[model samples]
Target chain A: MKTTPEQSEQRDGTATGPGAGLGTRERIVRATARLMQRQGYEGTGIKQISREAEATLGSVYHFFPGGKQELATEAIRHGDREFAEMLRRALESRPDPAEAVLAVAKDVAAELRASDWLDGCPVTATSLGTAAHAPDIRLAASEAFERWRGLVRDKLLACGFGAQDALELAHTVINTLEGAEFTAQVARDEEPLLIAGRHLARLIDSYR
Target chain B: MKTTPEQSEQRDGTATGPGAGLGTRERIVRATARLMQRQGYEGTGIKQISREAEATLGSVYHFFPGGKQELATEAIRHGDREFAEMLRRALESRPDPAEAVLAVAKDVAAELRASDWLDGCPVTATSLGTAAHAPDIRLAASEAFERWRGLVRDKLLACGFGAQDALELAHTVINTLEGAEFTAQVARDEEPLLIAGRHLARLIDSYR
Candidate 1:
């Protein structure tokens, strides 16, 4: 349960002292992404974003003219890149797709537990909260999922699976992980996620 | 795309003309559940619930003095009952656990499509939006998920699976379906759900 200084700051939702070296715009986007990870779109506000980023309100508007919506879109993109990077690293960790799937799940569970289950998939929490109301935000989330699926699909294909099987399993992998993460966060336990990972690995092995 | 009268009413978020025969409290709870399915707890309000239910603000307060949070908990319970009923019927439709998992997925996809993808899991949407802030709502959602996993586990056990396998696969079933449903709704397509369902059926068969 002991968190590092950076993790403690994120848990408090206060100033992002670790990111002080980064630029103002990057700080704002990262701050927004972090906030949206815990609370959904409706629960977050531009004023709070400013406070967390340690930037003035005027600087926030100057960086993003469209206000919260624009800032949130960028945050979604930021989260997307981070997750994609994680997926890339995990996919490369194992030669076999089945083991790779398990690795991805383990990584996600570790991250969630590290945050004390307070953090969840950034795209899912925000997109589900807004639903059809925010087209831009929804589109960002949709693209993030698609990219993750694509990365998995490619790994499966390279591992010698057919296109259809790879495509279907890719969808299953992302969907299951997204679902397991939400369940784990709510229960404040990592068992659901780890179980999901084990089952997904078995599923991939069956296809092989 | 064609909807019945009741479905159309829900789409418009207008008066529940079809539920005129139900009691005032039932109508209020149903309305809250329906609204929360599309929008999370934070996005919904007491005024909208009263209007949708065709009940006065006084009636709403009279039934639940705790206001939105109390009503939302009831709505989660209502949603839990409805989903549990659906799971029962689906599980009963097929003797095999694999087929039953597919049936549950198909039913969920059909329901979402019938609602024009405006609807999602009632508990997930509300809980993720509020997350850790509303203890009652969070507890209600947690209980709902546990009940669902239990139902699935019971089915697997009846089909001759061991206790450990049943429990883990049941978690996988609920978690995967929940994830696929959210992805399908976000993409405005049912393919993710159906794909997840197909893969889940295969996973169950492998267990056999």
Candidate 2:
């Protein structure tokens, strides 16, 4: 059987095909996420994404028929999953739930410090930019948030909080994490993240 | 005595003079703030602000010699003060500190609902947009946040929390409010705001 151009490209990771391999798609998504993280959804362009991804315009449209909005939706969902997994791993590394929450906070602070406070939660940036301009993107971002919240809620429930209490606590945890991220990013200091994390730990302790 | 052009414009609720009248400046700032509340600092343009305020581009430059950045600075500061004042009034209106906090939360929720969740904290959009691109804008945003945190801290202290406790609590409250606003705006729902407020009340109750 002879492989078609699209099939060959899909298999070789050099062309646009259903089997175009994961690397190409990953690269495109990563590039789009990075640009969106810096300039926001409205400010970023598909051309820039193509250039950043080292792929051509045809390749982008081939992979994402819905164009920038669809590409952004995919990138946001990818980032949310990757970030939540990383955070969950960080939390699980600690023995105590309180300590795990604090550890995750520190990890967030460390990441910000390493990036010179230039990076923030991609979901947050996307949510703000598209909440009004693009409803589908907003919904996609909201799904990511609910997923992250579920992760946190499960952790709190494991720590003995009731289901209702755990849900509320999870909301606070995420809210504080996000809020502290913005504060730390703007101030170029880890104090906000550290302080917010400590306060979150105390909140968990009260439940215990 | 004949009224100067500035004086006449000031009296007539217009700004058509050399120095520019209070009405014109106020209108410009208010319009800019409103635009920023919906979009963001980078997302908005001077032309848009001029049109919204019913003024000319020349008038914007005349009022803000430093251009868009300068206009944004003034608008963000004005927003900061207005938000602080609203918080203060809300907090002061209620006898109990916890009740005061809840009241402000309700007020914030109502405002968002009234606007169909289109409006959000003015500085949030700007802060996220400028966090990576413009350092000066980021600094300005940070200062505004510090001022807001200070106000919230004072209210918490007045309600009987210790200085350290109050500061920590204030940080959480602000973070929750900010996060909730982001979620509400993205979800196009007011429930997140109310949920954040209720969670905040619980945290405060535990301390009290």
Candidate 3:
């Protein structure tokens, strides 16, 4: 099991240590993702990203010449890849799609709790209300979601499920997990996500 | 069958005409909710609120001395009540709880599409990424989620689901719908929500 830099940063839960060793561009993108996870796109600023990454403001602009919007798209892509990696690992951990889906929910709940509810799905937080105004941010978020859904769909198809069932249930899995994560974060409790995991597992098993 | 000011405003999908006739305080709250639904809390500003509400800055401050946070709390409450009304109607529309749950998702998807995806759930838009920082906004959002969960739990209980089953399914219902609504908004398509509706209905039917 090889751990990517993004995975290590997520496990470390902060942009220090190995995160600091990453290049300035990677550091800035990671910082932006972390900030947007906590404060959202509009709430996060370049100065804060520079401060968080321990990089100069000039470096942030040097990497992201288009400024915040461009940087946010990259940050979202970073978040997207991180989540996809986690999802892939979870799905591979079990031969049964039901078990894999349950694993994802459990893993997500644990990670969110470990982050003290601060590390939400960056894509959802950044793009929640920006769809009408920020096309790039919204597009990045949408792509992230689509990618996750695609992964789930592929796994379900690899199982015995039909194509239509796999597609629709993939949407259900992603939507339920997304919603459950938000509820769990707000309540600062893991019950919602845990319950979602159990029921979603049952739903997936019924298809078999 | 009677429409309250909030219901009318939601139906109108704008803060004009009937929205204007509402008193300034109500107007301000409605405006805040609408803006936050599209732009989120941090992205929405006081001046923008005043402009949308057609109220003076003095009047806005006079009504909510705690400023944007206070006003946002009220706006969340406004959104909460409006959603409660919709949920109540949806739950009451059919004799079977499963049918009712499906109806709720359908109605929400239709409403989001009608708003051109600008009108998202106010509590979610305002509270995402802020739970760790904004206690007041976080509390309001938490209350709204709890209230919605209670509505679903009560409906499930009335349908003869065991106490434990009702409670857990209630969480699933809200989490899935919330997630589905978000995905639908980002995709500018209703398939996610519609799939969620079908799957949830099937999930509920499994209990029977």
- Model 3, range A147-183, lDDT digits (tens) per residue? 9999999999999789999999999999999999999
What lDDT score belongs to each candidate, Candidate 1 first? 0.87, 0.78, 0.87
| Candidate 1 local lDDT, residue B106 | 95
Question: Stretches of candidate 1 above 4 Å error?
Answer: A1-16, B1-18
DockQ score of each predicted structure, in the order shown? 0.65, 0.57, 0.75
- Can you give the lDDT of residue B30 in candidate 2? 84
Best by TM-score: 3
Tell me the docking grade of candidate 3: medium
lDDT minimum window of 10 residues, candidate 3 chain B:
B1-10
Model 2 chain A poorest 10 in a row by lDDT: A1-10
When candidate 3 is compared with the true two-chain complex, its DockQ is: 0.75
Residue B207 CA displacement from its true place in model 3, Å: 0.9
Where does candidate 2 stray beyond 4 Å? A1-22, B1-22
Which runs of model 3 end up more than 4 angstroms from their true locations? Answer: A1-18, B1-18
- Residues B1-208 of candidate 2 have per-residue lDDT tens digits of 1234234354443455323644566778888888877887767888998877767788788879988777777878888898899988987788777777788788988999899888888887866757665677787888888888898899888877899988978877887788887777777777777777876777788887
Show the colliding residue pairs in model 2. A10-A19, A10-A20
Each candidate's fnat: 0.73, 0.56, 0.84
Q: Model 1: what is its DockQ?
A: 0.65
Worst 10 residues of 1 chain B by lDDT: B1-10
